[model samples]
Target: MPPSNRPIHARPQAMRNFRNEMRSATMSELTMPVAASPGRLDEAIAAFSRAIGPEHVHTDDATLAEFSDPYSPSSWDDYRPPVVLQPATVEEIQAIVRIANEYTVSLWTNSQGRNNAYGGSSPRMPGTVVVNLRRMNRVLEVNDELGYVVVEPGVSFNDLYAYVREHGHDVWIDVPDLGWGSVLGNTMDHGFGYTRYGDHAAAQCGMEVVLANGELLRTGLGALGAGDGWHVSKRGFGPSADGIFMQSNFGIVTKIGLWVMRRPDFYIYGFITVPQPDDIAALVEALRPLLLDGTIPNQPEVFNDFAALAEGAKKADVWPNPGRVPAEVLDGFRKKSGAGAWNLRFALYGREEIVDVNLAAVRSAIAHIPGSTVNGQKLRGDDREAIEALGQPGQVQAGVPSMSFLSVMDWVGAKKPGHVCLSSIAPLRGADVLKIRDIVRDACAEYGYDYGTGITLSPRHLTHISTLFYDAEDPVAVRSAYDFCREVIVKAREAGFAEYRAHIDFMDHVADQFDWNNHALLRFNETLKDALDPNGILAPGKSGIWPKRLRVK
Candidate 1:
């Protein structure tokens, strides 16, 4: 395959020079050593094709373009691999792992590869074979009686949702904003959903993993020779190793056990709109108790004006040109669209009477804030609208998944659009949300971009996801968005907040920030990577945990 650098577009020479200088000083390109010879790389691809099938091994130009992330900051060439391999079963994965180890060919695993914002299906470094598991799509078990379902890496949220509904089970699975991603992939990536089971990591119970050396193992109670409760039991009699696999490249996850919720009796969905920018403090103070006390037992979202614009109003509806909207214009859009300055969406579950009491408590909590209006509609489990609403974006917080969230991509330029998202953990205090908003608002302004923010209430903390949107066809827009987001990551860290996740292009930079006691966290993860994968054949640069043999310089 031919090589290429970042896609360039017309921009000021001064700006390009400045960017190059800054990148050279701060972030230098790292090397994932190329294969010793073209013959070896060709041999590995042919061997993988023999192991899987000629049809399963994808290396055509069209397939390579499809594998490239259209929305990432750099050129598609930067993340392009020579081939993509599809495995249908655990046995096939094991065989491929053995072959990869034999050839020392790096493998990057992606579930559904629909994680568009954080680098869709792209490898952290180029030349690694993409192990896409879309063919292993299966709902192994949906045990309503046990309230847990087992699925493969390719089982998307939509797949699981359809399976459970068709099987006539009264179960709901938590999903992220977009429901096209894999159930196993989302959980392993620590993605967020808004439900009692919203925290995907917490909802995971068991895992089946294929190690680097072609060995198979199970985590949690499955570690036992005999166990009837592998899905429900999180801890085995001895050491539970499930936590180590999530977000790490030590192994390829074949199957995962997810705990979906039983259908609730009543559902109340609504939003509290605050008209003031500073009102985020009051909103946080109000919602923290309801969450901690279990009054509202689901993931509640606090979205600013831009989230509403991107989701409901859309950029095409307001500003066709790129740049931050004026404060007054944003306020007008929110008021017209019924999305206020800070819209707090809350959902209450359980019995009808209990929901009412909790609703009253929530109402009283925010009753003191001025210019705040509450709007909501309650639905019964059997209500037609409730069932119809299952296909909507915000319903994921209600334990239902939908692909409607992808509509946000079109807000900027719809035609082959791309975005970068950075998620950071914030203190639960009302003041912290304000600090977060200010940091992002200013950072975006520096680049003449919109400041999109969402504050999600976890039981005890706030996970704030800030997004930067751009059009893939516009190279200048792409670089600006990527460069600006990198600056925001550094600024937020200086303010004592660190992002939980980032795009593939920026993973190494983010990983470098865990400098407490001289980057002990990364050091420990490297030790595990070396011990688990000495040949460095599995996702060598994933999440910045590099294997010793393939360590980037």
Candidate 2:
């Protein structure tokens, strides 16, 4: 169960071989650009080495291979970029951006390269400069009293959590399914949290970003001082500039400030299942009272069958299935997860006595709904004993499933053709989630392909919803998967829903969701790219936000 034993580092043989080959190729061509001038490439590399030191300027086959291709389930030739550069400081990052702009070289920025499921960490264009931010990892400050922390983009949830606990701080990390992912990357992508502090984007107070033109801009309270940019307050005078950089390649975030939670005395984690699919509507109606009344303090995620089973990995010994507590798993799930109220994952946070009251209220509400039962276990002293168990992977009883689709997306290779996934988002609501899932499921069935979905409900904000899709790995399957993904996205727009994050390869296709005439924000990105990165240097084909390249008539 120790960290060293986790199979996380064990990549597939093919993936490893491809990485090694790519690394060697990168080194041989270190001084040469696929298209840029040799002098410019050398100057750029030299400037970068000067800024961060040559020790970190990796051109070796080992490091280069790791950066060349992304962990997407598709062919390497689909989204491979040539080189990678690791910058250690804000100044170094700014300098690199400046060079990229001047030389018209495309640069792709990545946090921990843990933006799994969507290929968010991959460069959309070939021969692009991947700006790896892992070395910038640091938890600059943790204000115990204010309940806020400032960190660089490379700070992973695991890293931040350890720092907080080791420092004797009375706070707990709001870990998503995967604990190794970057904190800033998740927030910037609008990732959901499972606890009370789940709406991490809302928890973020401020940021220090290095724009494509090498200018540093601080938003919110950090904007008050020219150089003092690490303030952890959520708002300030004038417009909030933080929203502009997120989900866009317009700027590079060097450092970020996020608000954490102060330890409360008692908390509860449990699930509620409703058996019938049609009854979900009624269940949602029942949930409104509890949500509005503050009885269910944490986010309650409702999962369809396939997702629930896909959540856990194939294993040996297992915990005995607890007897049905209150009701049966929901109906459609019988074919998939096969237990009783299609299932609802939920939790409670705050005073112990208050938690009990809320639990009672939740039971009462569910009891009113036909055939819905609520059964859950409240954590106690020894219940969470494994949480502090250190050394190995599963030692800690984090209550979250260890196997995640995000971690194995790249590993689940194509036996025949190829497999790619698409993650689409919608404003949170029971009906919208159900509708989207049904539409996509029907589409997959029609194509004679098996499709699955995973749901993550935003803890604080009920308006943000995320669904991940999985299918076979053949060219036809891959194309069909994308076709199905595209069809749903287009349908989502017509149905009044928009995605919060998209795969780097599909950004251009997904951009159609936003109407050009009304999408002023995207328009601003185009105008800014023209001004800051005039040659279309910083991630030219990224985010599908940039203009199309000119061609001969």
Candidate 3:
């Protein structure tokens, strides 16, 4: 039977039934892992069910659909897992891992499975059973004195924030634009938020991992059984193994200790805008000194007018053009909306007098940019009413959790809108910023797509987040978006830049670009993978580090 013609998101009762039928058919014909036969797969599933009750083992269409990537450039079928396991306890996870090893069935792991644009909960290798840890969601400890919290993989930003507030803790969580994702998961993936602790990986102090052999290991201070200062210290007596687990397939991270910001006595949310498109270079230049000099404590984000406009409006409603929207149209919209060609948002946290000094320094630094303007609001850290009134962007920068940024996905005006971000890191220089911008813009133009890009400024570098928005229901658009992303990545690489992270389809492509010393880094990673997971039962092809058996050679 042919697949339904209805939109992916517009699923009626009939469409749901069609999906159920498709899932049932696919399950019956499910492909087993390379090392496992049908009997072995069945045995593995049965073992997993026994380890963590059958109620927690999901094989139905409804549950599997939740794990599939919604914004995949290719069909989700290409990356879907055959089964999923939900384990609540570390012992259960260990049992599941042992069973997988025994059966030689590969396993993919996720926390809340909310890393949507980067493939969500989907596995890089098809047929790998997903071990989702959402059931392990727990705020194990919140130490107000030390300004840190220990959490399980399934503890999300919202969960942590609510826990802090409910307990009247004085610490704030650094949340990304969307707050539905797991805190430990985001940190493990090197994801960033918008506060002083925006560098999530750096903010992480400790980890508890379950290795492929079902060995429980703790990194940093946690390695000492006492657990004293585990959440506060980032280093142990020996080498720090925490960095290796990030963005790697070596182990499954079950728990993490993250540093949170203590509530500032005063907070100021600020916006800087420039009237010309090229003004972004100057804006970046002006802000660099402030960041380096510690005048700006948090990561500030600069959005092109298109990106700023996307947050609230749709492209079809504004331009209705076949190609890129005209500059005049964008300019007119900016004027009507009282926005600028480039908009920068930042935050200041300190004592009232110190924050005022920093605010003055920030204003003075950007004062030279022609037609530039700055404005903001000040609030006490305890003023919940004022913080709530500050809205999404302000609230996000202030270490508050919000899902409002999800609206940007709908800018393409598709019933099932989607986007894949192509991010590249460059030095915090105006010339470098402009170089990346031009490369990305040219690639979008060549592919006949609108340019949607933003630059996030860290202390020493800039993260260029270029989005390719498209209609997920349209296969042609999906392919085009993927093609555009690939081209942009190559262009950026040739221009002496590389992506900090990548979607599952592009992980190998991105990893291949790191060819220093005949790919010695990759070789080293493969060595680790082989030593840790001999049977290759863990996620293979993750970050392009295939196990010995799965290596192309």
How far is 14's C-alpha from truth in model 1 (Å)?
Answer: 29
Candidate 1, residue 68: the lDDT equals 72
Q: What ranking emerges by TM-score with the best candidate at the front?
A: 3, 1, 2
Global lDDT scores for all candidate models:
0.78, 0.60, 0.83
257-312: candidate 3 lDDT, tens digit per residue:
99988999889999999998788889888888889887898989988888987886
Give each model a TM-score.
Answer: 0.92, 0.79, 0.93
Each candidate's number of clashing pairs is 2, 28, 0
Worst 10-residue lDDT window for candidate 2 reads: 1-10
Please give the distance, in angstroms, between residue 175's alpha carbon in candidate 3 and its true position after superposition: 0.1
Q: Which residue pairs show collisions in model 3?
A: none
Among these predicted structures, which one has the highest lDDT? 3
Which regions of candidate 2 fall more than 4 Å away from where they truly are?
Answer: 1-43, 59-62, 68-75, 226-232, 313-338, 380-422, 427-430, 458-476, 516-519, 547-553
**Residues 450-515, candidate 1, lDDT per residue (tens digit)?**
778888887678988887877776777776676777788888898888888777776766776767
